[model samples]
Target chain A: MSYHSVVMVKQVPDTANISGQVMKPDGTVNRSKLPTVFNPEDKVALELALQLRDRYGGTVRVVTMGPLKASDLLRDCLYMGADEAFLISDRRFAGADTLATSYVLAAALRKLQPFDIVFAGRQAIDGDTAQVGPQTAEKLGLPQITYAEGILDAAGPKIRIRRKIDQGFEVLEGTLPLLVTVVKDAAAPRPCRAKRVMAFKNARTLLELEKMAEANSLLYVDQLKEEYVSKGLFIETMTADDLDVDLARCGLAGSPTKVHKIDSVILGANEHETIPANKEGMYALIDKLMDDHIFG
Target chain B: MNEKKQQVWVFVEQRDGQPADVSLELLSKGRKLAENLRGELKAVLIGHDVGDLAKELFRYGASEVLLADHPSLRHYNTLPYSRIVSELVDQHQPRIVLFGASFVGRDLAPRVASHTQSGLTADCTDLQIADVTYLRKDYAELLLQIRPAFGGNIIATIICPDSPVQMATVREGVMEKIPLAEPVAGHIAPIPYTPEDCDELVRIIERHREENKVDLKAAPIIVSGGYGMGNFQNFQILYDLAHLIGGEVAGTRAAVDAGFIDHNRQVGQTGVTVRPKLYIACGISGAIQHRAGMQDANKIIAINSDPDAPIFGICHYRIVGDVMEVIPMLIDAYKHKLK
Candidate 1:
């Protein structure tokens, strides 16, 4: 028996590279200034989905909600062996917090029905909120296992998962139509194959095709989209209207969280007593630390 | 719900019929917030036969305990717990809800918030109540959910302006719990919960627990190594030192990634946030990601060959030497002193 798995991925700004200019004075992120990358943990989630499909003989569909440029990440997913990729993009879906984002994703998932499993990264590096997957599961009325480290078995409608807890792990058995938020260490993500990368290199979303036609005066958008679709290179794109999502629950209007302030914290130790790199200095340092009850 | 009788609720998490430390910590913080808002601090507990823990909650500053006792809830399952908590929130519109940023809380809070359409902030370092104005609308007594973002380089203060119940999950060890004092008279409100037919989809088959490990959150001293430890074999020295000092050995994300340590032993933004009494960094260069997790330690000492290591910047004492060389000497000196 085959299984159908949907993996939710996101293109987040590389927070590790964030600098002073990345944060604007208005308490909003300067997205253009930060380089965008496929969120690291989402890749692991996709890897887990691909592994399940490889063993179970089904399909893996990767879905992401972001700007049109997120098509870049969709192509990466395709290159990494995703059977199908969908880009849920719309200006109306902008400025969404985790709640609104999950709402839109739940709506989109409902549109793509009859899925057996859904996978998402534990948390995004940018927002660092491990909320969306569970929230989406709640919205879809599905069982979710977060902090999933490994899939012990998946056969038919039953799936056993090894999930991480505070100090240990628990083996959980759940039915199909389940969502699992995978940790980064769950599995090592497979690299893009040379053949798949070349084959999916020209993949373009409908929005990207429109931009291509707009830039090239001779190329027709419809003709290019048709050609790409025929070549299995056109990434499926959806909008809020296409998904029939509630306008009120689609974006900033639906989000309850509002950023009140942003502060740049520069941590420093004004004064530190440096000990010499010798035996006597080591003894003295140990004495000082002991005096402070740092060690006995 | 009347404005004057509003309550602040804390999800009192438990394991093996004992209240988790983070639960007590949240109750303590929830009490202060409840006092500030002029409301009662209520602890919402869901478990099997956890009625006796209500007194413990009262001692920790909870004015009342709302408990839902059931055998199905003896173990933490997401669906039933979320449903009960969501129903409780809907029945009684608490102004603010707090949860410990434990595994159970992280999984349950968002589900409840989604069901009730309330906003939730995750892994908050601090919580306060203040007036907030957003988009020309002013909200008084909003929960200021402060958390580190951008890998601890920036702090963002969030407010739930639209939701009636503001929810937050606070990181463990970031807040101190009130001391266990003389038991105070408090009310226990029993919440009768019966699971729906389809609520039990996931079942725990077996639990594997690591034995004889110090919980980094509760560890008074953490002897942690970083990428500078060089190899997996070098971690043995750290274990030895930790054993000698009666502490636990933890590592940076790099060390974990290098396969020198397990993820549970990792201490960083992506790992566990630890606030021990003393944190010793060995060969850790101290990225902001690592600093965000342990900068709250009461005392920090760094051992790095590179004098310019950022770990030294935030540490109280700096030893400009190789950890491999320094740790051995310290261990020897300590052993001699003890003898």
Candidate 2:
């Protein structure tokens, strides 16, 4: 059977450059203050999926569940030769931790059926939680191979992958329909082919189409959407109506965790003690560390 | 409801038929945690004819050593190793699984955690049991794992809320390895292995080891050169100092950008986080990213001409002299001592 892979991608506000002014009084990030980029790892994942498609002769679908601003990454995915792309944008997907985010992504993955592989980045740079991929795999009930370094070999049904470990790497062969999380060193992503980029430049999600229609009168929103859909340039924008999503468990209502506070703390050494390389000296060092609450 | 007492599992990582040092480190930590919770500390040893390691593990603190020895297991393969680990974890539930945050730990922990439906926290600098008695009742309570967050600005204590086993991959030097003066006597229980246990199909064409770069993670004395070493040529000075000190030369994000060192040598938020005994910061302004990587070092001495450099903020001793001047002086002082 041919392989069909769907790579989940995300566009997150660049958290590395977050300043005091980046967070407004409302607790939401001021998007204008900070730039947004396609998550670096997710891009690596997309490349790995595309490579699989290139090697095995299959379709690579790119999916993103984010706000309308996320359509930019989806179009870029199309520019990079993804066979299909979907934008899961609704008010419900906002403010999701790894758990709730996995719920939404898994729901979306279920809607896009018939895939032998699902590739995801090891973790998002912003959150650095690295929980979403494994959680999604768990939800899908598929075998997962994370931190995969290279696709060693592949035959019918079973695919062999060389995975990186602490000291060295290990090779593993698993049956198809596997979920693999690619690392940054796995593969460098290919640049978008110029032809595809030009073709998909006009791709728009439903929300973007609606905004365009509101801004101009020459074209109707439906007319523009249908035109792009025929050219395979329109992102299949889905909402709560598209999937069998539990309304309660879909968004912030489903999210039970809340960030109470955020602070930048600086740690300085309170006391200094040096010990000799003897048993007695070692005990003294241990005692000091325990007294400082650094060790117990 | 009292939390169910879970057993502790240690991965006995062996390379070339010998056990790794980190395995002993995990056994030491595992022993303490297991003792505190009144749980069995089990060591999972997988290799060819490595049954002898079981006795060593016990000396360090392992109560039981689960040895899986097979010809296919001679070389570490993620497929077989993860399969065995996942199976062992499934058969005998481990409340906590500890791995040395070495390269292997970084790779294997994620795969095993995902397979067992457990949560894994990677590259933790600290591990502690926070309220063990109360948590035994909750299956989802994560053993509090703490690591530096936001470029060493704060220490974030993380827990895996739902996974039964709270797992963390700790950096090598972050935890002290317990050294026993004499090997304590212990017994080994051999875990059976079969051909089916080995599933890797990738054939190795070549195994060429690169010239050993100073593994910053393993290095005790890390001499890190930053942007202040004005040109790429200045990095050589750092190499000289590092060679004399019998350590590795590390670089801040700025120096890495200047093409002073390879990507693996980078120390920062996006780079490798190292906790060395003595981290000498030469000629680099301490960016948050740069500081995050090396802030865990035991003794930080910042050598910069500018007194107000951020490196001075975290350093134990701030040398307000130029790196070019100070590095030469130190090098001369050491040379004189040797003479």
Give the CA lDDT, 0 to 100, for residue B280 in model 1.
92
Measured by TM-score, the strongest candidate is: 1
For this target, which candidate reaches the highest DockQ against the unseen true structure?
1
lDDT of 1 by residue, B51-138 (tens): 7887778887777889888888898999889989999999998999998888899999999999999999988877999988888888
Q: lDDT score, residue A261, model 2?
A: 27
Q: Residue A184, candidate 1: how far off, in angstroms?
A: 2.7
C-alpha lDDT values of all predictions: 0.87, 0.72
Q: After superposition, how far is residue B107 of candidate 2 from its true place, in Å?
A: 3.7
Interface RMSD of each: 3.1, 9.6
lDDT (tens digit, per residue) of candidate 2 on B1-339: 547666888887876766776677778887778876776778888888777666778778776788888987786655667778888888878889988665556546655775675656666655666552223554333467766554334456666554566677765545567866765555687887776522643333333334335477888788889878998887799889888867788888667756787666877654667887778888877765577678888877677887667677787656676677677776765554443
lDDT of 2 at A93: 71
| TM-score (all chains, Cα) for each model | 0.93, 0.76
